[model samples]
Target: MTPISKKLSWVAAVGLLASGCAETPKELVDARAAYKRVSTGPAAKTNPVQVADAKRSLDQAEEACFSCWDTSAGRDKAYVALRKAEYADALSRNAMAGKDLEAGDVQLASLQKEYLSGVNARVAAENAAAAAALGTLGKTQAQLDADRAAAAAAQARAQAALDKIRGKLTQDERGTVITLPGALLFPTGKGNLTAGGKRNLDPLMEFLRTDPRKILIEGFTDSTGKAAFNQKLSQDRADTVMNDMIKYGNIPADKISAQGMGSQNPIGDNKTAEGRQLNRRVEIILLKPTN
Candidate 1:
């Protein structure tokens, strides 16, 4: 055998000989799958916060890789890259759920906690190194203070802009569909879009038209009534929004599509009045990528 081949075979034999009884580690397998999924999965609904979160995780994962310190092997931070990408996809779905989606509780909570922990760990490590480098004039301290101030200002502006966009659905957010508050959209036990609801949606239609993109208007209702009847009512409501888009927004008929998802995906607890309200909603989905 070639010298390198013999060395690799010896290494593999030693690794196996030193191991304890082994089955596949579920965590490792699951994590690897998630990583691959994020790298390859089709674009689904997502939002800015989720997008940012995913990217942060990915960056962290990449940085964690010891192999990344090397220039050859054509390798990236494989594990870290995977985790961050999938985490971002998860975040997108979580934000779309708003206050209603219970399924996102575990993932969203875990992500926030992990992110904070990672940030604290990184800062502590960096601060220790920086402290060791302090010179006689304390110029390093001054520079750090200035950097903090600039970062804080930038963060404030970013947060404000995010808040503005949160109330409205961006194309990324629509990938994770969540029913909006039914109470806000219509009266109790009614399928009709109230005048106030129509007024509120006026700005949304305008937003859609600004980009000349196709929209899918979906209507959903609670499961309190007959399924067949609710389906038709939901369709009718979706039609109402399409009519508004055509008449008021001047969007073309072919550019918009409408459907009803009556009682199929309740975003919140249907047992409570508030939850029921959260369940009934008109979702505006984008058919094509938008700015």
Candidate 2:
């Protein structure tokens, strides 16, 4: 070939190479770097299949750039490749973290077992020492008997006090509950206590003033109106009762609470007038002492 012709061909080749290099998308570059990092790191050993999938995606990106001459397609495939590499790396990290967590859990369980053993040993020693002291004193049995008698007397007194108050009294898991009909407490669709309502509550309030039991006043409504209106009305009535107990009954504020159980826990069918009357009632719950 002539010298000039050879030189021209070389120049054209250099230009093509420069253009190809310049046109390499940023996504492809980033994907190549990510794949290199993941493939050479721990992910390659722990998640080889994921690494291989990333490699295939990278290959497709390269193919799109060179063969298809589509920069957008190439970028999409490269992004997929980058995400796959990152996912593989994340999986490896998560697996390692899980192993660490499992090891930590095993260590914690061993520590707890050792602590419990020590605690049990100490408790047993204390019990044995107490038993010996009790045997020497000769009063442990007598003290226990006295405590049982006192507890029984106290329970009887409490029951007697509960019986003295006049209302529909019942015992349940929540303690002694006194149900007062809504019609007796307030005018229809109103929160203010009626004159008779105040009188009706006087006995219960007097009992609460003497007894130091915690009180929970729950106001309920029948399904006669919009639920929202009923809920607000019930809440207002409960709050008013709670305020009265605190203000007039001289009950400690901290020992009393109130809530509106809007149209819930119906004791009677809502369809009937009698049932609805029963459903719309306020309950005064005398909570049992926790101590």
Candidate 3:
């Protein structure tokens, strides 16, 4: 015989010799199946001691199964062993469930602690940032108030200087106005500025540099000329003044506008030489501030 076959035959003979007194019964079969199911389940890994106890009970029940139906003592022994096997399986499963519940409770408590700690840290950071922003805003508001006050004082000084430059000027509901005699500024029927005319405009230039006010220069003519001739002459004179202001006074050209009145809004009648001279004049209007 082969050596491997001889060893397997010896093992089988020993198993039969140990179970010689038992005849497998339905109760023993059921008890063995129940033990196998529990030993393969998660309870075996968590409660191996209880699984071993269930296996022992199943072995005892198989031994009692030989005469379980014919003898009362054997039947009673088989019933007791079956019950013990079932009880061991239930105990093992219950122990595993209790261990899982305890682990879950521990993990939940740790997570709650971590969550509360993170929330507190975030709230502290937010509060600190808000306090810093409020401090910066307070300083900014103070600086803005100081700047506004300085601007008001500077504007007051500029207004006083403007008054001195335009002698005999009037402040009506239309704002400040300055009148210049046409004879002093231009020759008769001409747009050229005389030497004396240039000197007279020096103070007006100085005031413009500081105040930066918007200006409108209007020129007028007497009724002695044709309407078209008068209109062109007045426009040329107004333009001459505006160009001189921009070139010599360093005033921005966009701040000033000029137009010809052509004898409109006359301060005197145009019949006499004196009244006509008065009608032929230039007027300067200064705009007011918004604030």
Clash statistics: count for each candidate: 8, 0, 1
lDDT of each: 0.62, 0.85, 0.75
What order do candidates take by TM-score, descending? 2, 3, 1
Query: Per-residue alpha-carbon lDDT of model 2 for 1-291, expressed as tens digits?
Result: 899999999999998876875688889999999999999999999999999999999999988876545678989999999999999999999988999999999999999999999999999999999998989676867888877786566455545544553347678988878787888889999998988788767666666765557899999999999999999888988988899889888899999999998898999999999999899889988888786
* Clashing residue pairs found in predicted model 2: none
* TM-score per candidate: 0.39, 0.46, 0.44
Q: Higher lDDT: candidate 1 or 3?
A: 3
lDDT of 2 at 247: 89
lDDT by residue for model 1 over 1-291, one digit each (tens)? 999999999999877754522332343344456655654543234444544454555444444432333322212343444555666667655555664566578788999999999999999999887777666338767888877876465445433433443333333545523234555566765666688766655655545565444678888887778998889878888887788888888888888888977787786677998777667777776554556
lDDT of 1 at 8: 98
Q: Write candidate 3's Cα lDDT for 28-105 as tens digits.
A: 667667777777877677667767776776666555555434544555555666666667677777877888889999
TM-score, candidate number 3:
0.44
Q: Top model by lDDT, which number?
A: 2
The superposed Cα distance between candidate 2 and the true structure at residue 225, in angstroms, equals: 0.7
Per-candidate RMSD, Å: 43.9, 29.9, 12.3
| Candidate 2: stretches off by over 4 Å | 1-166
Model 1 spans > 4 angstroms off:
1-179, 289-291
Select the stronger candidate by TM-score from 2 and 3: 2
lDDT of 2 at 210: 57
Local lDDT at 98 for model 1: 64
